[model samples]
Target: MKVYGLTGGIGSGKSTASRMFRELGAEVLDADVIAREVVEPGTPGLAAVAERFPGVLGPDGRLDRTRLGARIFGDPAERAALNGLLHPRIRERFLEQAQALADAGVTRLLYDVPLLIESGLHETMAGVVLVWVPRDVQRERLMHRDGLDAAAAEARLAAQLPLDAKRAHAHWVVDNSGGLESTRAQVRDVWNQLRARD
Candidate 1:
């Protein structure tokens, strides 16, 4: 199976590219989805998190993700603790899903992970695809998309490896700073190259 790592900065249209890959007949294993799954109510991850970070649960017995994000994003120690707790379980789930897909005869798989570079997961993939945008565009789009101020957007962007740095590490790079049609065209081109094992 060809497992490709797809990553990008926030608001860089990584999700959009992932959907395009699926449309082009690639199985996409999304880390963000797996991360949420591992932390759902009644799960061991949620229980561990609730123990470590009290008051991060909602009245309905579910994890309050926004509150949790606010608590961890500003503190490296807290963020590291959260990642330590969740990343392993998320990896386990990803492996299970990948095995299932491989068993089902899927040849192409894209692992959509936002922090693929920061987490050093690119080494595990057959190739890496970077969906890229300029820092200014990314910050503006993030602020508008997430209802954050400029400073908050900048902080969030600063938390990850820069897009230019990630580009150097990628096997493929898709520029998503333009319109959807352009991005779609780039995705199609990349998909062809991937299928060709380029």
Candidate 2:
């Protein structure tokens, strides 16, 4: 089975590409979904989180992600601290799930991981799929979608590897600057080429 790590910067249309991959009949794993799952309600991840950051949990005992995001986003040290605490747990879950899917005979798996470049996880993949858009478009999307001020949105973008760099690193690049239909057509063409392989 080939492990294709699908990655892109924030607002690069990774989410949309992931859905298109699923629609094209590829088994897809989302790192963000797995990250959230590993820390749900009564899990060990939740307990660890509580121990690390007191009162960050909601009254209902769930992690207040919005609060956490606010606390971490602009602060480099805080962001590093959070990543240090979460990356190990998240990586473990990813490995376990990937292996299980391999065991179950999934041949062409797509792991949608936004941190692929920064995390140095590109080496783990058989190939990489990077979704990309123009920098201006990405900034505009993030502002409207996440309601971030220009500076904050720019900071968020700066936190990740540049989209053009990601595209250069990718085995396949899906340019999403055009309309959704154009992007989907490109994705479909790529899927056909991928499916033709072993």
TM-score of each: 0.97, 0.94
lDDT of 1: 0.94
lDDT of 1 by residue, 26-112 (tens): 789999999999999899999999999999999999999999988998799999999999999999999999999999988889999
lDDT of 2 by residue, 130-187 (tens): 8999999999999999999999899999988889878767988899999999999988
Candidate lDDT values, in order: 0.94, 0.88
Among all windows of 10 consecutive residues in model 1, the one with the lowest summed lDDT is: 189-198
The TM-score leader among the candidates is 1
**Clash pairs for candidate 2:** none
Pairs of residues at least 3 apart in sequence or in different chains that clash in candidate 1: none
